[model samples]
Target: MVLTDTHTHLYYETDAEKQDLLFQRCFENKVNRLFLPNVDVSSIAKIDALVEKYPDNCFAMAGLHPCDVKEDYEILLKEIYQSMAGKKIYAIGEIGIDLYWDKSTLDIQQTAFREQIKWAKAAKLPIVIHCREAFDEVFEILEEEKADDLRGILHCFTGNLEQANHAIALGFYLGIGGVVTYKKAGLDEVLSHISLDNLVLETDSPYLAPVPFRGKPNESSYLVYIAQKVADIYHISIEEVAAITTANSKKIFNV
Candidate 1:
């Protein structure tokens, strides 16, 4: 079975030997595809290097993460937007409003999010969103920017069934991650009512590790745990989850 991690930060692992082992574990687990989303300007090079090293398995995206938005963000964001000039990218994200970290930056975050959305729309690329405790805020912007071609994955989605449906209505696939395996995350319950067609799998790794590795650093190899949890929810085999979600990833990333 070929599994796909629709969103991951595995490129953050810089050691050559260690990064190889990480890819080994991912491949050994049948997690054959990984999409890397740049969190800030600095991550562009890291992501480019990894994708260049593993062109067959890794894809890259560019965007300034909401949490990274700050005063003087316009200048930095311009740099990020321009960084996409010579590189090939599948999306313009991990961008969206994140109210959990700092409500103070909400205004700038929204502006950054909208500008990135414009970038994606102009490029005709899908957007991988990074919504966190700001569904209402994010949805408002998405609603405003909603267009026939406005489609992508909502990375690391942890919302209720209503929000899931709302996102689907707005032309987005909900990105299910390690949180689905958490006992109290309620994501599994939410997935019970959402079809595989409207869903995709992710690890968001080096973060949100699944059970058995919940409190530890996450990696793409652990995507199986999240897939298994999703399989259990949908009453299907892990292979089916892999097949469907990987297909969903290809539909989103065109890879």
Candidate 2:
């Protein structure tokens, strides 16, 4: 069973030994493909290097993350946009409003999100949205920019059914991750109403690790646990979850 981790930060690992072990674990778990999202200018080199080294397994995306948005975001975004030229980026992502960290940068974050959406449309690529504590803000921007050509995933979706339906209605897939395994997350109820075709799996790792490994550093290898949780939620088999979500990832990333 081939599994795809639609969002992971393998580039964040600095230790060669641990990185190799992580990749080995991922392969052992049949989580072969990993899509790495860009955070800011500092992440470019590491992202590029990871993709270059594991050209077959790793793919890179270019975008300024919402949390990274600052007063001089214009300059940072310019460099990110320029780097996308003739590059092998899968999407313009991990971008959106992030009020959780700093609400002061909301204006700049929205501007960056709008601009990056334009870039994604111009490049004919999917976008991996990173919405956090700003679904309304993100929806507003998406409403203005929505079109038949626009497509992407709402990475790490943890919203109510109304918001979930809204995102699906906009021709975007909901990216399910480790949070689904949490008992009180209420994601299972949300998943019960959403179709499997409109869903995709992600780890958002070295971040949201599944239960049993919760609060620990996450990895792509743990995607199986998330998939299992999704299967249970849907009353389906883990194999079916793997097949469907992998297909969904391919549909979005075109990889």
Candidate 3:
């Protein structure tokens, strides 16, 4: 069963030894493809290096994260726009309004989000969103920016059935991650009404580890656990989950 981690920050680990070991475990578990989302200018080098090292396994995205949106966000956005020129970025993402960390930056965050959405559409690529306690804001922008060419994943989706359907209606796939394994997350129920075709698997690794490994650093290798949990929730085989989600990933990334 080949599994795809549609969203993961492999650049979070700087140690070569740890990186090697983590990737080795991922390979062993059939978690072959790891999509790395750009946080900011500082993370670009690490992300580029990882994609260079594992050209076949790692894919890179170019975008300014919402949390990283500060007063001087225009400068960062300019850099992001320049980086996207003639470069092989798989998506424009991990971008959206993150109200949890700093509500003060909401205005700029929405501006960044809309601009990045324009970038994604211009590049004719998919977007990977990172919405945190700003579903209404995110959905409003998506509604305004809705178009035939606009499509992507709602990364780390933990919303209710209505939200799930809304995202699906807006041409997005729900990114199912380690949160689904949480005891009281209720994601299992929310997922029950959704179809596998509109879902993708992810780890958001180095964070949000599954049940057995919760509170610890998450890894791509732990994707199997998330897949197993998803399989259980859908009453489908883990292999089926892997196959469907992997196909969904390939469809979005065109890889």
Candidate 4:
């Protein structure tokens, strides 16, 4: 029952003092191996600090978030590269097209996504993608970039089966989150066609908390609930889902 949360924002307003209790709870539930994704320049310091504090438990990735892409993107991207320079960034991520908030940055977002993909290839690190209401746009950039040397996970995947298949075809893993536990999410249909080998479990903590605590701030300890729901959906034991997805995560992040 060792569950690995492949994606989470552990550095998101999470205090270092509370980390001990958080680790205790997660370890008690066999949830370890947390990966942190950097949103923008503002997050780089905090993310680095967290990783430094828990190098064994928390791993980090560096990239500019899509929502942060704007006129000042060039300056921010330079800062991102500076932070990642000579550092072992687990991935280039939380990066992709996000049309939900601001569509004005569509062109810049696409450029940033492609640039990050190039960096991922050069750095030889997997990417943790963030896509929302922009699958076609994201997929279009990914295809044009031809990221053959790049591979990663689609964090908080809300796409249909066809999108999942396309991502898989491009050597990416689907990141299943608390949304899957929602009865109305329609994730079960996508899960039916996605094998466990191509899936990884995540909580995206402080965000998508699973059912029974659906509206509360999420924690890594709640990853068990997400795993349980996935197991129930696939008609498999919780332990099986934990082991398989943990292995899948390790295989990708090389942890």
Backbone clashes, each candidate: 0, 0, 0, 0
Which is better, 2 or 3, measured by lDDT? 3
Error of 3 at 139 (Å): 0.4
* Model 4 regions lying over 4 Å from their true place: none
Q: In order, what lDDT does every prediction score?
A: 0.92, 0.93, 0.94, 0.89
| Model 2 steric clash total | 0
lDDT of 4: 0.89
- Which structure among the candidates has the greatest lDDT? 3
Q: What lDDT would candidate 2 get against the real structure? A: 0.93
lDDT of 2 by residue, 1-255 (tens): 988999999888999999999999999999999999999998988999898889999999999999999988999999988887777899998899889989988888988999999999998899999999999999999999999889999999999999999999999999999999999999999889989999999999999899989999999999999999998988999999999988888888889
Once superposed on the true structure, which residue ranges of model 2 sit more than 4 Å away at CA?
none
- Lowest lDDT block of 10, candidate 1: 185-194
C-alpha RMSD of candidate 2 = 0.8
- Model 3: per-residue Cα lDDT at residue 210: 96
Per-prediction TM-score to the true structure, in the order listed = 0.98, 0.98, 0.99, 0.96
List, residue by residue over 192-225, the lDDT tens digit for candidate 3. Answer: 8899999999999989999899999999999999
Q: Which stretches of candidate 3 lie over 4 Å from their true place?
A: none
lDDT of 1 by residue, 1-255 (tens): 999998999988889899999999999999999999989888988998998999999999999999999997898888888888987899988899888889999999999999999999999999999898999999999999999989999999999999999999999999988888889988888888889989999999999999989899999999999999889999999999999999988888787
